[model samples]
Target: MNPHNARIEHHPVLGTLPPRKTIRFRFDEMIYEAKEGETVAAALLANGVRTLRLQEEKGTPRGFYCNIGHCFECRVTVNGKQGTRACLTLVEDMMEVISGKPFSSPLKKGGNHA
Candidate 1:
Protein backbone atom coordinates (compact mmCIF):
# COMPACT_ATOMS: atom_id res chain seq x y z
CA MET A 1 0.00 0.00 0.00
CA ASN A 2 1.08 3.58 -0.62
CA PRO A 3 1.71 6.18 2.04
CA HIS A 4 -1.39 8.06 1.01
CA ASN A 5 -3.48 4.99 1.53
CA ALA A 6 -1.93 4.34 4.92
CA ARG A 7 -2.16 7.91 6.15
CA ILE A 8 -5.09 9.13 8.15
CA GLU A 9 -6.12 12.32 6.46
CA HIS A 10 -9.01 12.83 8.74
CA HIS A 11 -9.50 12.06 12.39
CA PRO A 12 -12.57 12.38 14.54
CA VAL A 13 -10.70 14.03 17.33
CA LEU A 14 -8.05 16.04 15.44
CA GLY A 15 -10.09 16.53 12.29
CA THR A 16 -8.55 16.81 8.88
CA LEU A 17 -4.92 17.72 8.63
CA PRO A 18 -3.89 20.88 6.86
CA PRO A 19 -2.18 20.66 3.53
CA ARG A 20 1.56 20.43 3.88
CA LYS A 21 4.39 20.39 1.42
CA THR A 22 5.40 16.90 0.32
CA ILE A 23 9.01 15.92 0.60
CA ARG A 24 10.99 12.94 -0.60
CA PHE A 25 13.28 10.81 1.50
CA ARG A 26 15.16 7.60 1.01
CA PHE A 27 14.81 4.58 3.25
CA ASP A 28 16.89 1.52 2.62
CA GLU A 29 17.73 2.91 -0.80
CA MET A 30 14.04 3.23 -1.62
CA ILE A 31 12.47 6.64 -2.11
CA TYR A 32 9.22 7.58 -0.42
CA GLU A 33 7.19 10.75 -0.01
CA ALA A 34 6.24 12.26 3.29
CA LYS A 35 4.73 15.47 4.55
CA GLU A 36 7.15 18.14 5.60
CA GLY A 37 7.95 18.03 9.31
CA GLU A 38 6.86 14.41 9.61
CA THR A 39 8.92 12.12 11.75
CA VAL A 40 10.74 9.24 10.10
CA ALA A 41 8.74 6.65 12.01
CA ALA A 42 5.46 8.32 11.07
CA ALA A 43 6.41 8.46 7.44
CA LEU A 44 7.59 4.87 7.45
CA LEU A 45 4.38 3.72 9.05
CA ALA A 46 2.38 5.69 6.51
CA ASN A 47 4.29 3.86 3.81
CA GLY A 48 3.31 0.52 5.37
CA VAL A 49 6.80 -0.11 6.67
CA ARG A 50 6.72 -1.92 9.98
CA THR A 51 10.11 -3.47 10.49
CA LEU A 52 12.51 -0.74 11.49
CA ARG A 53 15.43 -2.83 12.72
CA LEU A 54 16.37 -6.19 14.13
CA GLN A 55 17.02 -6.98 17.76
CA GLU A 56 20.75 -6.83 18.42
CA GLU A 57 20.91 -10.13 20.22
CA LYS A 58 18.07 -12.23 18.79
CA GLY A 59 18.05 -10.78 15.30
CA THR A 60 14.29 -10.50 15.61
CA PRO A 61 12.37 -7.79 13.77
CA ARG A 62 11.57 -4.52 15.52
CA GLY A 63 9.27 -1.65 14.67
CA PHE A 64 7.64 1.42 16.18
CA TYR A 65 7.09 0.68 19.83
CA CYS A 66 6.89 3.21 22.64
CA ASN A 67 7.20 6.03 20.13
CA ILE A 68 8.09 8.60 22.77
CA GLY A 69 11.81 7.98 22.42
CA HIS A 70 11.87 6.07 25.71
CA CYS A 71 12.39 2.76 23.87
CA PHE A 72 15.06 2.50 21.21
CA GLU A 73 13.13 -0.09 19.20
CA CYS A 74 12.79 2.36 16.32
CA ARG A 75 16.50 3.02 15.96
CA VAL A 76 17.80 3.48 12.43
CA THR A 77 20.74 4.98 10.62
CA VAL A 78 20.26 8.49 9.29
CA ASN A 79 22.68 10.27 7.00
CA GLY A 80 25.31 7.60 7.71
CA LYS A 81 24.86 8.01 11.47
CA GLN A 82 23.63 5.04 13.47
CA GLY A 83 21.31 4.85 16.48
CA THR A 84 19.03 7.73 15.41
CA ARG A 85 15.55 7.22 16.75
CA ALA A 86 13.09 7.06 13.89
CA CYS A 87 10.25 8.27 16.08
CA LEU A 88 12.12 11.42 17.00
CA THR A 89 13.98 12.30 13.84
CA LEU A 90 12.29 14.51 11.27
CA VAL A 91 12.35 13.65 7.60
CA GLU A 92 14.36 15.95 5.40
CA ASP A 93 14.34 16.31 1.67
CA MET A 94 16.73 13.82 0.08
CA MET A 95 17.51 12.41 3.49
CA GLU A 96 18.85 8.89 3.54
CA VAL A 97 17.76 6.41 6.18
CA ILE A 98 19.09 2.92 6.53
CA SER A 99 17.64 0.10 8.54
CA GLY A 100 19.86 -1.13 11.34
CA LYS A 101 21.11 -4.71 11.51
CA PRO A 102 21.69 -6.91 14.49
CA PHE A 103 25.24 -7.14 15.78
CA SER A 104 26.81 -10.54 16.18
CA SER A 105 25.80 -11.88 19.56
CA PRO A 106 27.20 -14.98 21.14
CA LEU A 107 23.83 -15.68 22.73
CA LYS A 108 22.21 -16.13 19.36
CA LYS A 109 21.89 -19.60 17.95
CA GLY A 110 24.64 -20.50 15.52
CA GLY A 111 26.41 -17.28 16.40
CA ASN A 112 30.14 -17.12 17.05
CA HIS A 113 30.72 -18.66 20.45
CA ALA A 114 34.06 -17.08 21.17
Candidate 2:
Protein backbone atom coordinates (compact mmCIF):
# COMPACT_ATOMS: atom_id res chain seq x y z
CA MET A 1 0.00 0.00 0.00
CA ASN A 2 1.27 3.49 -0.90
CA PRO A 3 0.75 5.82 2.05
CA HIS A 4 1.32 8.84 -0.17
CA ASN A 5 -1.43 7.68 -2.53
CA ALA A 6 -4.14 8.12 0.10
CA ARG A 7 -6.67 10.80 -0.76
CA ILE A 8 -9.60 11.92 1.32
CA GLU A 9 -13.01 12.23 -0.33
CA HIS A 10 -15.15 15.21 0.59
CA HIS A 11 -18.28 13.36 -0.33
CA PRO A 12 -19.02 9.66 -0.61
CA VAL A 13 -20.67 10.34 -3.96
CA LEU A 14 -17.60 11.91 -5.43
CA GLY A 15 -17.69 13.45 -8.94
CA THR A 16 -20.76 15.09 -10.49
CA LEU A 17 -21.53 16.85 -7.23
CA PRO A 18 -24.09 19.60 -7.58
CA PRO A 19 -23.53 23.17 -6.48
CA ARG A 20 -25.05 24.12 -3.15
CA LYS A 21 -27.78 26.72 -2.79
CA THR A 22 -29.19 28.72 0.08
CA ILE A 23 -32.30 27.74 2.03
CA ARG A 24 -33.99 28.49 5.33
CA PHE A 25 -35.49 26.34 8.06
CA ARG A 26 -37.03 26.84 11.48
CA PHE A 27 -36.00 24.70 14.38
CA ASP A 28 -38.13 25.35 17.41
CA GLU A 29 -38.75 29.10 17.26
CA MET A 30 -35.47 30.09 15.67
CA ILE A 31 -34.85 30.29 11.96
CA TYR A 32 -31.68 29.01 10.37
CA GLU A 33 -30.11 29.59 6.99
CA ALA A 34 -28.68 26.55 5.25
CA LYS A 35 -27.65 25.46 1.81
CA GLU A 36 -29.95 23.77 -0.63
CA GLY A 37 -29.37 20.15 -1.67
CA GLU A 38 -28.09 19.64 1.85
CA THR A 39 -29.74 17.04 4.02
CA VAL A 40 -31.59 18.46 7.03
CA ALA A 41 -29.36 16.45 9.30
CA ALA A 42 -26.22 17.52 7.47
CA ALA A 43 -27.20 21.18 7.64
CA LEU A 44 -28.03 20.86 11.30
CA LEU A 45 -24.68 19.26 11.96
CA ALA A 46 -22.91 22.02 10.08
CA ASN A 47 -24.83 24.64 12.07
CA GLY A 48 -23.69 23.20 15.44
CA VAL A 49 -26.97 21.48 16.24
CA ARG A 50 -25.23 18.22 17.11
CA THR A 51 -27.73 17.19 19.73
CA LEU A 52 -30.59 16.07 17.50
CA ARG A 53 -32.54 13.60 19.56
CA LEU A 54 -33.20 12.99 23.24
CA GLN A 55 -32.40 9.80 25.09
CA GLU A 56 -35.54 8.00 26.21
CA GLU A 57 -34.09 7.04 29.58
CA LYS A 58 -32.87 10.35 30.99
CA GLY A 59 -32.88 13.03 28.29
CA THR A 60 -29.21 12.44 27.49
CA PRO A 61 -27.63 13.87 24.39
CA ARG A 62 -28.17 11.97 21.14
CA GLY A 63 -26.57 12.83 17.86
CA PHE A 64 -26.33 11.42 14.37
CA TYR A 65 -24.08 8.44 13.84
CA CYS A 66 -24.95 7.49 10.27
CA ASN A 67 -25.59 10.09 7.60
CA ILE A 68 -27.83 7.47 6.05
CA GLY A 69 -31.37 7.09 7.40
CA HIS A 70 -31.06 3.39 8.22
CA CYS A 71 -29.52 4.15 11.62
CA PHE A 72 -32.58 6.06 12.94
CA GLU A 73 -30.07 8.13 14.85
CA CYS A 74 -31.13 11.35 13.19
CA ARG A 75 -34.80 10.88 13.91
CA VAL A 76 -36.49 14.19 14.70
CA THR A 77 -39.84 15.94 14.53
CA VAL A 78 -40.66 17.69 11.29
CA ASN A 79 -43.52 20.13 10.98
CA GLY A 80 -44.90 18.86 14.27
CA LYS A 81 -44.47 15.10 13.91
CA GLN A 82 -42.25 12.25 14.91
CA GLY A 83 -40.02 9.61 13.28
CA THR A 84 -38.94 12.08 10.62
CA ARG A 85 -35.69 11.14 8.92
CA ALA A 86 -33.69 14.36 8.98
CA CYS A 87 -30.90 12.88 6.82
CA LEU A 88 -33.43 12.21 4.06
CA THR A 89 -35.39 15.46 4.36
CA LEU A 90 -34.57 18.30 2.00
CA VAL A 91 -34.42 21.93 3.10
CA GLU A 92 -37.34 24.15 2.14
CA ASP A 93 -37.65 27.70 3.43
CA MET A 94 -40.06 27.94 6.39
CA MET A 95 -39.81 24.25 7.17
CA GLU A 96 -40.45 23.58 10.84
CA VAL A 97 -38.22 21.24 12.89
CA ILE A 98 -38.40 20.11 16.49
CA SER A 99 -36.49 17.76 18.74
CA GLY A 100 -37.41 15.28 21.48
CA LYS A 101 -40.56 13.46 22.64
CA PRO A 102 -42.20 13.71 19.25
CA PHE A 103 -42.42 17.44 20.01
CA SER A 104 -41.23 18.17 23.55
CA SER A 105 -38.03 17.19 25.28
CA PRO A 106 -38.22 16.45 28.95
CA LEU A 107 -34.54 17.28 29.03
CA LYS A 108 -34.24 19.65 26.11
CA LYS A 109 -30.97 21.51 26.01
CA GLY A 110 -32.19 24.39 23.84
CA GLY A 111 -35.79 24.71 24.92
CA ASN A 112 -37.11 22.58 22.05
CA HIS A 113 -40.71 21.50 22.47
CA ALA A 114 -42.18 18.04 22.08
Candidate 3:
Protein backbone atom coordinates (compact mmCIF):
# COMPACT_ATOMS: atom_id res chain seq x y z
CA MET A 1 0.00 0.00 0.00
CA ASN A 2 1.20 3.53 -0.82
CA PRO A 3 0.21 6.99 0.32
CA HIS A 4 -0.41 7.85 -3.30
CA ASN A 5 -2.88 5.01 -3.46
CA ALA A 6 -4.98 6.17 -0.52
CA ARG A 7 -4.89 9.02 1.98
CA ILE A 8 -6.55 9.13 5.41
CA GLU A 9 -7.79 12.63 5.47
CA HIS A 10 -10.92 14.77 5.46
CA HIS A 11 -11.30 18.41 4.45
CA PRO A 12 -14.05 20.96 4.18
CA VAL A 13 -13.78 20.97 0.40
CA LEU A 14 -13.68 17.16 0.40
CA GLY A 15 -16.55 15.18 1.79
CA THR A 16 -15.87 13.19 4.94
CA LEU A 17 -15.18 9.56 4.31
CA PRO A 18 -17.37 7.06 6.09
CA PRO A 19 -15.89 4.44 8.35
CA ARG A 20 -15.62 0.91 7.07
CA LYS A 21 -18.33 -1.37 8.32
CA THR A 22 -17.51 -4.95 9.36
CA ILE A 23 -18.91 -8.39 8.66
CA ARG A 24 -18.02 -11.95 9.66
CA PHE A 25 -17.21 -14.96 7.49
CA ARG A 26 -15.59 -18.38 7.67
CA PHE A 27 -12.55 -19.57 5.79
CA ASP A 28 -11.72 -23.15 6.53
CA GLU A 29 -12.30 -23.90 10.21
CA MET A 30 -11.51 -20.36 11.19
CA ILE A 31 -14.06 -17.60 11.48
CA TYR A 32 -12.88 -14.15 10.42
CA GLU A 33 -14.41 -10.76 10.19
CA ALA A 34 -14.54 -8.42 7.23
CA LYS A 35 -15.53 -4.84 6.63
CA GLU A 36 -18.60 -3.86 4.72
CA GLY A 37 -17.91 -2.71 1.16
CA GLU A 38 -14.38 -4.11 1.46
CA THR A 39 -12.93 -6.71 -0.85
CA VAL A 40 -11.96 -10.13 0.46
CA ALA A 41 -8.33 -9.07 0.39
CA ALA A 42 -9.04 -6.04 2.55
CA ALA A 43 -11.08 -8.10 4.95
CA LEU A 44 -8.41 -10.77 5.12
CA LEU A 45 -5.77 -8.13 5.65
CA ALA A 46 -7.77 -6.75 8.52
CA ASN A 47 -7.87 -10.20 10.07
CA GLY A 48 -4.12 -10.86 9.67
CA VAL A 49 -4.84 -13.08 6.68
CA ARG A 50 -2.22 -12.68 3.97
CA THR A 51 -2.43 -15.67 1.68
CA LEU A 52 -4.86 -16.25 -1.17
CA ARG A 53 -3.93 -19.18 -3.40
CA LEU A 54 -0.93 -20.96 -4.86
CA GLN A 55 0.73 -20.02 -8.13
CA GLU A 56 0.29 -23.41 -9.78
CA GLU A 57 3.63 -25.23 -9.75
CA LYS A 58 5.65 -25.25 -6.53
CA GLY A 59 2.83 -23.62 -4.57
CA THR A 60 3.48 -20.11 -3.37
CA PRO A 61 1.65 -17.70 -1.13
CA ARG A 62 -0.04 -15.07 -3.28
CA GLY A 63 -1.85 -12.21 -1.64
CA PHE A 64 -3.10 -8.89 -2.84
CA TYR A 65 -0.66 -6.75 -4.78
CA CYS A 66 -3.16 -4.81 -6.84
CA ASN A 67 -6.40 -4.06 -5.01
CA ILE A 68 -8.25 -3.46 -8.26
CA GLY A 69 -8.28 -7.23 -9.12
CA HIS A 70 -6.49 -6.79 -12.48
CA CYS A 71 -3.37 -8.64 -11.30
CA PHE A 72 -5.33 -11.74 -10.30
CA GLU A 73 -3.07 -12.18 -7.30
CA CYS A 74 -5.86 -12.79 -4.85
CA ARG A 75 -7.94 -15.50 -6.40
CA VAL A 76 -9.69 -17.87 -3.98
CA THR A 77 -12.84 -19.93 -3.56
CA VAL A 78 -15.95 -18.22 -2.35
CA ASN A 79 -18.69 -20.51 -1.10
CA GLY A 80 -17.78 -23.22 -3.62
CA LYS A 81 -16.83 -20.77 -6.35
CA GLN A 82 -13.31 -21.43 -7.58
CA GLY A 83 -10.80 -18.91 -8.88
CA THR A 84 -12.74 -15.97 -7.50
CA ARG A 85 -10.59 -12.87 -7.07
CA ALA A 86 -10.55 -12.12 -3.37
CA CYS A 87 -9.55 -8.57 -4.08
CA LEU A 88 -12.63 -8.09 -6.19
CA THR A 89 -15.16 -10.01 -4.09
CA LEU A 90 -16.80 -8.20 -1.23
CA VAL A 91 -17.24 -10.13 2.02
CA GLU A 92 -20.67 -11.12 3.26
CA ASP A 93 -21.48 -12.18 6.80
CA MET A 94 -21.05 -15.93 7.21
CA MET A 95 -19.73 -16.22 3.69
CA GLU A 96 -17.49 -19.16 2.98
CA VAL A 97 -14.03 -18.77 1.39
CA ILE A 98 -11.21 -21.15 0.69
CA SER A 99 -7.85 -20.62 -0.91
CA GLY A 100 -7.02 -22.83 -3.85
CA LYS A 101 -4.15 -24.16 -1.80
CA PRO A 102 -3.73 -24.64 1.90
CA PHE A 103 -0.89 -23.29 4.06
CA SER A 104 1.44 -22.09 1.32
CA SER A 105 2.91 -19.23 3.32
CA PRO A 106 5.83 -21.37 4.40
CA LEU A 107 6.65 -21.97 0.77
CA LYS A 108 6.46 -18.27 0.12
CA LYS A 109 8.82 -17.47 2.99
CA GLY A 110 11.15 -20.25 1.86
CA GLY A 111 11.01 -18.91 -1.68
CA ASN A 112 11.52 -22.35 -3.02
CA HIS A 113 9.12 -21.71 -5.85
CA ALA A 114 9.04 -18.56 -7.90
Candidate 1: Cα lDDT at 82: 97
Pairs that collide, model 2: 21-36, 103-113, 103-114, 104-113, 104-114
Q: What is the C-alpha lDDT of each candidate?
A: 0.91, 0.73, 0.74
TM-score of each: 0.88, 0.69, 0.69
lDDT of 3 by residue, 31-97 (tens): 8766578777777776677777777656777778888968878888999988898878888989999
Error of 2 at 71 (Å): 1.3
Worst 10 residues of 3 by lDDT: 1-10
Candidate 2 Cα deviation (angstroms), residue 91: 1.6
Pairwise lDDT winner, candidates 1 and 3: 1
In candidate 2 the C-alpha lDDT for residue 68 amounts to 84
What is the TM-score of candidate 3?
0.69
Q: What is the lDDT of residue 42 in candidate 1?
A: 95
Error of 2 at 8 (Å): 12
Model 2 alpha-carbon drift over 4 Å, by segment: 1-19, 102-114
Model 1 is weakest, by summed lDDT over 10 consecutive residues, at 1-10
